[model samples]
Target: MPRFMGFVRMEEGIGMPPQSLFDAMDVYIGEQAAKGVFLDGGGLYGTEDAVNFVVRGGEVSRVDGPYAEGKEVVGGWSIMQFDSLEDAVAEQEKFAQLHAEHWPEVTVVATLRQISDGPEAPGD
Candidate 1:
């Protein structure tokens, strides 16, 4: 089975939503988990808590966040396993729909990406 990561990106200045929103999200996530398709998921703190490391030549430098130029940052993520990309996408659609119905006032963008298996082993 192939694995996929579904992530949410939010624009700058977006803060934590209301308790009702969180409750609704929890119910949706719980339902998905019960189906045995959702592997794991969690939300992240604000971007101010992030750090970026850059390497140039032989020196390494660290850039602290509160990234002013960043238009959006990952807010949360979910990992799931599916038989194919289409199946993964269909699952994501359900998540998106939940957001659409529960948080219609807020703009949320969810994206999905397949997880790579890394380098293959030597010939069998």
Candidate 2:
């Protein structure tokens, strides 16, 4: 199985919602966990909590990000192992739909990154 990292893009100005809504979402995530497909997932604070960095003139400068201009920012992420890209995409679609219903204006990009084994460590 291939591992996937799911980035969740979220809408603007959606401060905390009612407690019940969070509870419902918790249940949904719990269901995923029960299925053994869920590796990890969590939400994030807003853009203010972000930081961006750039390098120039042999110096490193820092700025707040996920790059400001975008309509949606990566609010959180999840890691999962799936059999194929199609399976990962299906999960992304499911998450996108849920995000749409909760935050209609948000846009999402679910990317797939491959992890390969590197050189062995000194021990074994």
Candidate 3:
């Protein structure tokens, strides 16, 4: 089985999803959890209090968030394991559809990436 992380990205100041979407997601996530496909997941607060430590040329610098230039941010994420990529894609489609049906006014990107198993890549 392969494990993948899926997350949704939205505009920086976009508010939270509506209660109807929340209720619908609960049911969807519950079903996946019951099948042991969902591992762990949750929503994150906005970047208002976020901090980043950047390193360059052997020096570390801190950057505080509520970033004025950042146009998008991750809103929620899920870690899941599935028998195959196809299965995962199918599930992701359902997740995205829920947003399209419930929160039709806002645009969001549902991204899925397979978790790396070897080693971390060097950053530039």
* Cand. 1 Cα-lDDT: 0.83
Cα lDDT tens digits for candidate 3, 19-102: 999999999999999999999999989999999999999999999998888787888999999988889999999999999999
lDDT values, one for every candidate? 0.83, 0.66, 0.91
Give one clash count per candidate, in the order shown: 0, 1, 0
In the range 36-56, model 1's lDDT, one tens digit per residue, is 778999988888879999899
Which regions in candidate 2 have their CA more than 4 angstroms from the true location?
17-21, 64-70, 103-124
Candidate 2 clash pair list? 52-63
Which 10-residue window of candidate 2 scores lowest in summed lDDT?
115-124
lDDT order of candidates, top first: 3, 1, 2
Give residue 58's error in model 1 in angstroms.
5.4
At residue 72, what lDDT does model 2 achieve?
Answer: 75
Model 2 CA RMSD to the hidden true structure, in angstroms: 5.4
Best by lDDT: 3
RMSD of each: 3.4, 5.4, 3.8
